[model samples]
Target chain A: MSSATTTAPESGHGHHHHNPEDRLALLKQIWMFSTDHKVIGIQFLVTTLLMLMVGGALALGVRWQLAFPWENMPFFGLLFPTEGGQISPEAYTMLFTMHATVMIFLVIIPVLAGAFGNFLIPLMIGADDMAFPILNALSYWFMWPAIFCFGASFFFGGGPGNGWTSYPVLSAVPEAAPGSGFAQFFWLMGVTLVGVSSMMGSVNYMTTIINMRAPGMTLFRMPLTIWGMFITAILQAFALPVLTAAGFMLVSDRMLGTCFFIPSGMVINNADPTVGGGQPLLWQHLFWFYSHPAVYIMLLPAMGMVSDMLACCCRKPIFGYKPMVYSMAAIAGLGFIVWGHHMFTSGMNPALGMTFMISTVMIALPSAVKVFNWIGTIWGGRPEFNTVFLNCVAFVSMFIVGGLSGIFMAAVPVDIYIHDTYFIVAHFHYVLFGATLFGVFGAVHFWFPKMFGRRMDETLGKWHFFLTFIGFNGTFFPMHLLGVAGMPRRYADPYLHPYLENLLPMNQFMTICACLMGFAQFILLFNFAYSLFKGQKAGMNPWLANGLEWVAPSPPGHGNFAAVPTVYRGPYEYSAPERDDDHWLQTEPPKSSPVPEPPKPEPTPDSAPVGEDTGSSS
Target chain B: MSEISHDTGSHAHDDTHHYVNYFLIFIALCICTGISVLFDVFKGGIPKSALVFGVMAVAVAKALFVMTYFMHLKFEGAWKFIILAPTAILAVGLMIALAPDMAMHYYTNDAPQVKWVGGEHAEEVAETEHSEHSEHQHEHGGH
Candidate 1:
């Protein structure tokens, strides 16, 4: 702590008040199309947070309906219809469908991979900017049209009623669902645009990571966070195109009179259908082909960030760093082969089911290895019970439940009962909400000072974490029981079933917990907003963390580094026996050697107006 | 050959490449398409499977030519093959996995009934297995 305090002065070239012209131009550049990765990252953060709020509101509505199945005479319920605020079946279908879509596509993916990945990669790798700045901006810009399409779908007639998977036959025909008309078209187009945006971001991420690493920052020298993001980017690059193609085929089915996914059904509403000779299962196959990898796409970045934060907070090197990296790689590689697991009950061949079950079970091995390594990393180390550390620990514990529960679904026998049940809902929420969402909370807290140049209130942050952890468990854990009791998911009314009658009290309880959880998130939102300006000023290396990102000033300038930094060691050099401080800087000179001053830049024929690289001799 | 240098600070690399050979490959692809069409035209006497195999071979050849030359994969280094090989293998593997489903129609016996529009005619669910089992066959024959 003393060493960090002593060194803080050197790094405190904090933000100074700029002239009016400079301030106006900076504001304009930030709000408009700025190519800086940091600004782009902020844009993604703000946009995705807003999307999260919208998705959360939809989830509340869903819970509201479930809590009081038919008694929906409320302020918000009036938006659906005049029938005493009771949610119509059509609107209820739209509620959960749009909720899943917005959360997965708009919030999680963008906030985790798009925002943090963009912001941290250049800083972590000691690069100035992404390989293609214009392309990066285009990736962010592409999301807008996708968002607009999603909003426009509601007004076109209704929003898409099909689940996020949007399986065909039901999703294909306008006659099948109320919103399956022009609205479905808008939904398809929105997804396609998002796919394109993700593709652009992935390409930029891959190229920049591969090509723009600073001198001495070899592949192995990279932080686990970068590796996580890198592998996630790779998954996105390959997997998203499959989804795009699926979306295209679906669009053709809807608009171009094609029967790619529509099966040869003789009757709909007791009337002979015009479309025929397509396979509905084809949609499931293609959708899951990308979607299964998409699960890793959401999880990997969080895993990576958690690894880094754990290493930092524990004041130790991450245990089995190589194994951790390999496990993620293995996870990504096995992700492709396990897509068939999602299709086991879709009238797929039993032999194919056996093959898929084996692969799906095998994929869990690497994830388990990662969990073991995280525990090993934290085993003997002194830990700071900061909000970041608390959330990260929650991620590990909750992810174990998420991972172990997946085994039940991966086994064909068990999945038969739990396929569309609340059990599956609980399984995914543990991973998505418990693991990834918690990771998001942790990473934001850990990096907020570097991001906004202010510290978030520690007391407030801890309260947010505890309430969220308790509320999340309270809401979702009972779902496993409900599922075991044979409660089916996506049904507007479970009261219709005699078997589901007793589950009403439990549902009511869960809904109350869910509302509490949703409200608890506002503490985070408030903490984030208030701390951005009014919180205590954060100096560089406030966490005393060992990474190149901490070497840069808090909220780094346009090009990030004052001079191109040469990395001398791996990111986690914490608690080295010889070092007096808990962490060692990657760029620091050895004790035997005096600090070398920057060499004068020699004029070159191809010299641009940009500052010359200052070579620091180690 | 256009040899443009992409000066991206510390990671400046040359992205410029020759284009004249790409045009030649395009011409070759055109010839291959013609050959494929010729196979289809003269296949009246040939076995249908053999004709399909011949056409597929020509398409593969044309695709390789385009990927290697027109797509500039030849000059793009080893990573191009590394990235592309797995994608090709997985795609083909998925197709193979789907072969049984493509070749067989399972709903000839008892099939899931389509939900009717407007929620009318929805109360046969009690004996749905027995009744729809016999009725679906008629629709299968009609298709």
Candidate 2:
């Protein structure tokens, strides 16, 4: 990781190295440290996957309990026995809480926002790498302390059980619960670290996307993955900081006797505490203000990847390409106004609830447009429903199912009834598992060839998708019914409601589905590892995607394209008659456009062939 | 392709162009923080959020001067603005969102355990207290 810099001097041949590589020393240097964006992206991806497995295993333990409540189980019950009884109420709460936190902050967000976002941004835009390489390394490292703190809570005391939302009355007072003190601290620190990592990553991505696009690669003539990452980064820049402040405020209230989130005269265990006059709702306002947008920050990049992959695999210009881009911006802009949807049942003002409801309903429109655009994208094209394409298509299907459930909750009256119930559970799983992780699977399969220069076993991948998809829906879809039947979420036992007798069977069924879903991840793991060593070699453009990354060598070198690409047309120019192939890379010139697009070559790359900028496309 | 460095940049000190505003700011903040700490520890009075934010305002002003002149964010690129615009939006958004919650703590009159807020409700309550017993009158005297 050293380079020679030629310097002009009286001694004409003299040059110096900023970091001179001496063979053995250089190997150690490269092994110990390097600030390459690709290296950092790979590091983030690997870290995210490791945490995913750990989190997933914890989830399996949880599912085991629900499937066979208070019974001796294979792995989890034995490991987490509470004095030879069942898993304790506190432990069960902590496990569920940490599982969600780890999966969201540690896995899905990092895998997309930090990993693929970093790995793809420079390559797609034809830059060597990210704008600030050293800061990139620091951001990844900063994530570790936060993770370590959260992990350490298991040993020091109870883990955070306030749910990933960390609603204040549950999270504020250290003495509020058995786990609140140390567990909540660890959770806050972990979340805050993630915020720092995301902000740094956002700054790097936005700057690179803006300042480092190759010659002739304008804004509109870029892949949707870049557009997704760009918007996600912009959203992160706006969202993560508010959450950071929220975490800091929570910590201040806990440790320093600041009454920022506690109101006077509240009784915890029939005892009044010293802290007073802070409102708990303040915490919710702050937390959700960041977290609601954080949902898009979590999911949008995957959507971008799926759109790009689906277009390429189908050999069609993406249907309503302009709508896809504008819809994303609309989603982000609308995201800020809708955080109150989460708090409608938390005793929010009825008027504000309606406003938030309308915004929440409005949020669904952009996504529905995306869903329509996705269906239309695959329709009327020479289709190739490969495992990658299936996963891509599945992302839309799952998102629709998940997204439609969101509309039910967005209606203020329905939300009041189902706010903290299993219906909410079904709604989000349809989102995180159905949509976000569905996109993640597509991304992993679609990019494995580019990332490793080897194709994943298609059959194994299909098996993985089928089992995960069915298991996911089977597990979550019933929750909507359970929630409507008054099955409260985050409960250790359904017996909390004596009258809800019939739901036990449904709960058991969902738990079984959840366990089976967890089991299928191993198929993916096997496919990933086996393919790394034993898979077929994927030459560049195996799927024949019309993006710049494919034109570069497979397992692209550090500099990506051998020649810096000059982008020439919209990313979705496909199936045109003038082109020999069905696709056109954005980096290719319209004048050099082999495909016959009927519209005249106006050469305006920033806008749609016929559309306006600076306004919503609708 | 060119290789990246394996070490932290050593030329950081060689440049020797330390920011004047940053230096002056560091000195000024150090003195102010010293005085504030002394006042709090000796005088037995601590600053509120408003005062702390005021101090932070001064520090932020100083830091911005340093970043523009020293860190060179001022001349960096349009992308830096692109990066920063959203951060500004989020900070303002959080304050806007948090304001109602803070206001609600004082405004929600139905909650009896909490004290009466200094508003029309408090005025109404004060009138009632004056009409009631001497103890209620004492409670309403300063409140």
Candidate 3:
């Protein structure tokens, strides 16, 4: 292995001497079906970005229906000429359902775990590549089949309209709704395959992080990004199997004459009575069992990434690094038990609801710890206030709003009122779109230099951030008021009710803000595209960060590094007093003496000042 | 300095192969399965709760035998517990959480018992097949 490291310098430059034909072939090989982790990460990035547009368009359709109920809509209204450009009630159901489906399965999960997780994990941990490179590539390819299933659902009679939860009886009985026939089947298949892809990726991540670390890159010394990815992998591996099982059972009930979620003597859509005695609530149990932990799976990686970004932009060590790790683990663990909170309105036992409520509230302890620690990290440092810093701050601010609203839902009595209201919708958007997506936006800017050897236009990036933040708040904040006003979610036309008719103006305001938010993303897409070719060339270590990845070349070649980097201290060693430079690199040997032993239990903040580890070692 | 070169290979390098009687474990698993089946077969004689408990216990024993011997978790490091414990806890917790609604049948009477009538309108269907039991009305009172 050391011999390969020695010969890497010559082989790395060999690509430069290739003829035009060979270069084209090499480009085709790398971009098309390459198993390089970096290429796979970019593949996920591009694919999920496209899906984000699709999901956003679906959401805009949903908003249009709400703001101007039964009115002829633009763009989507063209598809429904029979209704004079107005979306049908059934189409409205499919709109919100597919919007959530694409955002969760296709966009957020893939972009975080599949995109950033793949690109950062091996580099940050000083590994050459993922533990299973072929399996990693397979994970990205498997997403297409899932995407195909989801896309195919739309053609097969309007798509699954039972919402992303797909609670059965409606989902199981094919004749139950306009979209329940083959569209629901395809949706189930899509979910199952997405679970399969996620399972594969999580297994690969766990193995790579556990076994493939370079020397001195111990579990504790690894970056919080790695810790978040590692814990998220564990959550995915444990929770995804249940979703896959539930998906299969639903498919069987619809297609294979099984009754896992169907009960007897129930006639839906004028069909013959169902004969099976299987319970509908059973699906809720199995689904939420996986889905509850999945909320953290969507979140913890961003939490991890935001911690790293906040420390970097703030020029401070993350406040209580070990505590942050423990809290993340605690969140994942508690995530499993608190799933019953989602089932409070399903006529679950009061005793069970009480148990779930307690666990759900207890989960808030870890979340609040993370929020406070983030604020603490930003407290005393001379902050950079760049695009990265601004987005990280937004993530913290939005997470507080999301986390506080979640507490209300955790209470049985409160949840009973707001269970199916727009309030629930607002709470999750703040978490998923507000917190997680903002973290992703920050990360994309922070790591764009490393991903493409170029920096995104900071001015453009900040504009994207501000528009998104303002648009996001304007769009979702009013939903809390709407929910309190007794506006139910998934309603095609709430204006039909006299009590809710007064809220039409508020809904219209929110829809306009949503359109602004949706269009502001084009600035990001343009920045990404324009910057890829024309943006300023960012030398390695552009951010002047302390992590091991800063030691690698910008847009690192095939194996990610010329040689495996050996870590000395933790990743967040910014602004140490002993060093003249503000940043330190993990691979830098101590200037005066050999690297000291890792700190003992009572770890001091300024204990290890290895060297003036400033320039790019690559 | 700890000079660790990249070694993308198998981490498990236990050369010492422990002797395990796989045939015996297999036979034990089969016997456990047979016992559970027998309990189910004679369920009429046994009390319903005892039959269920006895069969589930037997099934658990079989699973343990498979995981310990066939899956070689017994020979694995203590990390096996770290990995398996949460899953075990969650599985049990899920059962505990599900038991009240699924097993207890607490609100079975209030559960909607819909009948199919050959009609398009819901009002006509409701009038013909009227079994709209209120959720609070407990048809079966004190246990």
Candidate 4:
């Protein structure tokens, strides 16, 4: 195929030729309530990045309390000077609770699906825009209400202290804790709105991916990123309604004198005993039902993007593409059944726990398949050691650690011993912070030129990655040992207990490392801001990726392509013997392809079509 | 590059519209609801398991009617099975998974049941509280 077909339209309307004032005005117009998928994706990216800082700050507070109990914290303690610059235990509870809340809801999930998914889906699939552009914008707009609700909760009764899971009785009864009343109500509202936002996005993605592929962009021929997104959309569509329903139920239980999750004869805070026959365990079942799959919802998109980046950086055809797709589907399928693993310690029956354990362990099979495929893709290839590649490698390495730790938690006996300990905390941080965030960082750099017309500074990016990698390991790895030493999570001060007193120094060390990790993010933020203005100009296809997105102009115009490109082969056709170039674009047609066929006239009653039925299948 | 001609005509507007009697389906759903309500109202005479099963069966029938007719799943292509089957399976699977703990209440004590203290016991409690309040008032008056 002629490259000129894709590049010709961009020549006349180059963004760089415009005056700075004109470009600024154009950007301002696009940034404000625009229905363009690219604008909405950037909107999500910037918003989530801000929320990531907020969540990170909350995490630092938790670390400070763990490291130096009851002593004056640097910035946070000043907010509570009435208690002699020390954070109250209730404040400590809120810190960790909101930390997880902001990280999972505002940062990881949105950054993956809302930011990268929205931006990449249309571009990668060779579509001009989403199937429903208005609905896509609405999805981005919906996130603000959730952010507002979560932010407002901090002012009202010190925010929801009952953890991110929001298990009811604590979440249901308003009088249960200081934050359980209006603050918890706000938290639930926030969660409900996030669900609404996600539901809208999932529907939009599903429709766009299924129906809006360009001519010849068949499902099998699409990149694994699209497949990952497609499967994640399906998972969200099926799973989110349950969580939405459960969230509303929890809300009702809190406000409307309903008791869906609150059992009868429960007294909280010397208050009157509750008088309803609702089961607390039911909440666990429902919450984990969505949240277990939610774990994959958080990771799978990153897994897909990492696969693409890995192949490009390694300059190899992805090893076992079909297997990768099948494995993602397998992971999503098994994710549902293994939710029971979360509820094993909640007094669920042993038989049910056993089934969950087995299912959870079985998820490892598909995950291992993906890991092997990624490794195979890396082997026997000339590799580029760019920032994107480093982060991709980190994602794989960290995910292995996270997935291995998860197996121990999947077993009934082992999990019972370490349930709610720092081990569970270590395991998920490895996955969420270690794997998903690193993958997202790689994706941001990889696609920065496509989003804008510039590349992020690689030198600063390397510094940021190394500091983060070292600091992240230093912070979280010892938490495994802390878990083994019986350091239960969500404690205000574990050192208060004699058995855990000696662990204080280790906690302090982790706290210092956490600070380092937290500060390293500033370098990233600075790099991003500086690069937006001063970074080197990148032409289209900076990474020389094989995906359809690479064919589009850097910072693609309103309708992404000058002409819609047709796919002739699968996305990962690197190093084909038929071509001298290492990478072959999906749209590139074969040199000697046959072109004799012409359209036949439609058959009528006088000239009936032979050998085929023309009737609709339905 | 030779542009491939897209067969957009294949997805042209179908003039043939399948009309379903939504009113009749709504009536069917109402009848199913009435049956469930009747079963629930007369649950005292029926065995608990039978009553639960009968009411649930009626509910399922109502859902089927709505899905097949009102939602036009019956007129949809075989892709409806692809979409609905996994959802149906997961829903049933979740229910089954939840049963061991939620339904059976295994190992743990049965869900605590709060008894309604009505008819006589409520009056006694009220009378005792009233006397206690009057005596306390009298003591306060004396003081």
Candidate 5:
């Protein structure tokens, strides 16, 4: 920040203060776009939701066939209908692979990092906008071509079938499946775009958080949200390049015939494949290097959001705030080490597996600390029954369910048995999709009033919650049972065996539940669109939640805080008996606020009323 | 001009983030690359001892870079640097844990069985399972 210390003091308000009269042309602006973090967040939000549905539907189709093998699915043939009725084996493989890609790269990564991280980082840190606005917009726009390439996979006769890991031989050879080599290319290209987008977002976040805290808002005084975003960006900065490099190698192998992942010797389609002298496990090494930390990338920010939301709603000073901070740092550090947990069954040595297992178990400790801190923050505070509060609680509950099951995978022997089983599916979906997505939902709802100047329908929100909670569990929970009964995964038709027959009924039940979960979002869609106009008009601080965000004008004016807001006390100042207000705002100075000189009697008719209270003094 | 407050009172030229530091990184990287390459060559002659020392050098250099730059300790606070120091050690420690399994695969009498395609040029190399396994059909090799 120093070389630039004398750089140029910003216009502070210049970037955001341009009048509407001087607006850029629509087409021109769309091409070059505004660098407003809010705009970038919305861009991420809309794109990711569209992809989520497309991916979710794919999951339903796969589940549909597995529950009832050989049945007549709407399109793409049968499950194995002797000839054709539901999904084909190739289609099944394609479904599984594409579903994972859409969920992780499109849904989780963007929604967590791109959407929430972009929207909140600047606002939370009290900056007018990101450090580099144009670059931020470029990073977001870059995602479009990447997504287009990914969606193109399905139409290329089929999508990637290498199970999202895209291991060589299976992913490298054209004969690996009926899919056109397009799937591999699409996966590589999509991930590359995602990596690029992540890198840009990371750099922007790091720079903004470091350079732009409001006066008196020192590092410790900054809210946990900023802390989470900062660490996530740091992880992304170092980790994403490895994945980008890995994706390029895979791209070259598929399109240009250079084998970075394929080992020496092998044949495909009765012809010797040119892919030789490449290590299959090396791809795993590089991919997991980015991706395992990527899991933390997805989780930590949401954890940060959930932490803020819980403390705000419960009106309590964040319990053990410093410990919570320490835990986040610990988790990010431990995350890089535990990638081997994913590779245990990839033929890693038993000693290495044991070491990974120990490291994996250690991660649970910091996570446990975070969970305890959340619960402690809310323990005795008068709880609000608002949508945001409930969702925060839901996030914690889901996280607990998600975290506890991770222990199963943390153990070496347990993972070996359940390595590629539905059990693994159940465990991660609970963590990644269930817990993390719930955190996102809570954040959106919590921030909706602040973003839109309108409060969401509580009734509809509640209905949305129950249906999602039940449906998510119903959909993922059965996989645990099926996995236990030794029903092998990745099969288009599991009913091929009589022993697995009992699980089909459960599978069908799960599929039906999954569809119900899909429909539950329609309530959300209704809530989102309907609330835009007809919902109750929310003034600033609708929930009376305490944080700097509430103190800013509703919908937050061009610059975040009206005046420079200095921090007074910690983030969660709930039920501070010393104050009359039940919830304490972060920008509100403590009990003995200030005793300014007794106001001088004003002259006639208020010439220009002088001596206003300039925000707060810490 | 916009007013962005700078607290230069506690600030000085941060040697770690200064442009000059880039040269240091470059020099360090060259040395690391040199060490790795040297070890690889020496392993051809004294494989065991060179392999151990070479990796150790690369690991130390990488740890230094991460500590000084990515973690931004050289330009920032000791507390942050202290927090940042261990992740590199953790990553390499994890890698070491996996080394033995990779070692076993390389050393075991077992060789990767290469399946014959189109029944051409299938021949055995010193009673190996892979090159001549047209009819042998090892169990683990198929999947």
Candidate 6:
């Protein structure tokens, strides 16, 4: 194990002298089935973005019908040319259901946990690659069949229409809903494939994080981003199997004559009921059990990435690093028990509701701790106002709103009213979109150079961020008012009831804003594309960050580091009085020795700097 | 750093003693399966719920044997339990939350029309079905 800090740049370039024939074969390997973590990360990024576009298109269709009831859609209506281009109630149901499914399962989880998690975990922890490279590759490739199956669901009697939860009775009996038959089967198949992929990825992540860190890179010395990926992988490993089993039972109920969820003596579409001796509430119990932890699964990596970027740009150590780590762990631990919060309105025992409500409210303590720690990281420091920093700050601000709004729902009495309203919709988007997407954007901006060896234009990036911020607020913030006005969700037409008639103007406003926000994302796509070739070339340590990733090449090669780096201190070491530069690199050997020596002695607490002795610095 | 290069692979070892132990565990698992079958064969005298509980206990024991021996969890460090703890706790917690629904019957009769996803017309359908279901329950006793 040679030190990467001593590796020469010329040695890496010397490998380029291979013959053209060999080069072509190498290119094929790199593009097609390479097990390199960076390549897989890019693959996850591209695939999940495409899924996001598909899901976004569905959302636009949903918004269109809600804004202008019975009105003809322009470009998208051509896809479904029934009822003179107007979105049918049936189509609208499929749109929203698939939207939630694609976004939750396909887009957010893969992008945050799959793409960035794969790319950053090894690099930050000073590992060469994932512990199981083949499994890492399989994780990304598995999504292809899943994406295909999800798309195929549309052709087979329309897509799943009982919402993403696919509640039984509606999902069990094909006669109950239009898409309940074969389409729902495809939905289950697609979800099961995704679950398998995620579980495999989780195992790989856990093994790599625990067993593959560089010599001195202890668990506490690793970056918060690594911690984030570690906990998220654990969450995925445990939670995804339950979802897989639920999906299997669903398939059994629909295809086989097994009565797992359908109760006896029930009529479907005004016909004789066949299934017997099963509970519909059982499906809710299983789905939410997996889904509650899934909420943390989506956001934890983002929070971790945001923590890293925030510490880097602020030019200071992350405030309360141990607290940050513990809070995230606390969130993951509490996440599993609080699933019943989603079921308060769901006719489970009302006594259990009190238990879940207490657990759910207690989760806010850790959430608040994370928020205060982020603010503390930025306090009294000359923070860089780059696009990444702006996005991280926005994530914190919006996450505050998201967390505070969650309290309203955490209280059982308040939740009983807003359970299925647009307010619930508003609350989640603020967390998912406002908080998580902002973190995703920040991370893309922060790590774009490392991933692509070039910088995204800061001007375009900042413009994209501001427009998205404003558009996002305008789109979702009004939903709180609409919810308070008693507007029910999942309705294709908000004009169905006389009470909702007054909310039409606000609904139309949100749709327009949502369209603007949707269109503004193209700016990011353009920035990403154009910056790939045209932007300024980035150096190895362009940001002058403290992580071990800075010791590697800009876009690291087959093996991330020439030699796995030996860490001397924690990832974030900023404003140390002994260093000339404001930030200190983790890979840098300690300078206390009178003479610089080869094969430096491993850094122990006795000889390290003041901050290094803390043992928990990130 | 050189010493730690292959630390991840250190857990893999070929020990004959462990293999013999695994074989012994496998035999124990087989014996448990046979006893569970015997309980089922003589089901006339034993209580039905006790028989169910007995079978479930045997199944749990079998799963533990497989996980410990075949899965190599017995040789692994404390981190093995760290992984299993949350999954087991949450599973029990979910069952706890669901206990009321499973034990106590909530609704007097199954209202077939009152589907969660059946929307507005389903509610009206439920109104008609409610009256009919109550009469049916009066005649046949609730299912």
True contacts kept of each: 0.08, 0.15, 0.23, 0.46, 0.12, 0.17
List the DockQ of the predictions in order: 0.09, 0.12, 0.14, 0.24, 0.10, 0.13
Clashes of 2: 7
Better of 2 and 3 by TM-score: 3
Candidate 1 DockQ category? incorrect
**Candidate 2's residue-wise lDDT over A155-262, tens digit each?**
546678788888776687877776567768877888889889889989888779866887666677777888889888777876677789879989887777787787
Candidate 4: residue A74 lDDT (0-100):
85
Question: Highest lDDT, which number?
Answer: 4
State TM-scores per candidate.
Answer: 0.87, 0.81, 0.87, 0.89, 0.80, 0.87
DockQ score for model 5, please? 0.10
* Model 3 chain A: lowest-lDDT 10 consecutive positions: A609-618
lDDT per residue, candidate 2, B97-137, as tens digits?
A: 65554665434533333446554477778776667767677
Across residues A65-149, which tens digit of lDDT does each residue of candidate 3 receive?
9988898999999989988998888889999999999999999999999999999999999888998888999999999999999
1 versus 4: better lDDT goes to: 4
Off by over 4 Å in 2: A1-32, A589-618, B1-93, B104-143
Candidate 6 docks at the CAPRI level of incorrect
Give the winner by lDDT: 2 or 4.
4
What TM value does chain B of candidate 2 have? 0.43
Candidate 4 residue-wise lDDT, A8-60, digit = tens: 22322244432345335546854689889988898899999999999999999
In the predicted model 2, the residue pairs found to clash are: A262-A278, A567-A587, A578-A594, A578-A595, A578-A596, A579-A594, A579-A595
lDDT of 5: 0.73
Q: Could you say which candidate leads in DockQ? A: 4
Give the lDDT of residue A611 in candidate 4.
Answer: 8
lDDT for every model?
A: 0.81, 0.75, 0.84, 0.84, 0.73, 0.82
What is the lDDT for B109 in model 3?
34
lDDT of 5 by residue, B1-143 (tens): 13333434334534335554666786787788788887777776766866887688698878878667765666654434223434445456545644565334543322133344213335434445553575556545666
Interface RMSD of 2: 6.7
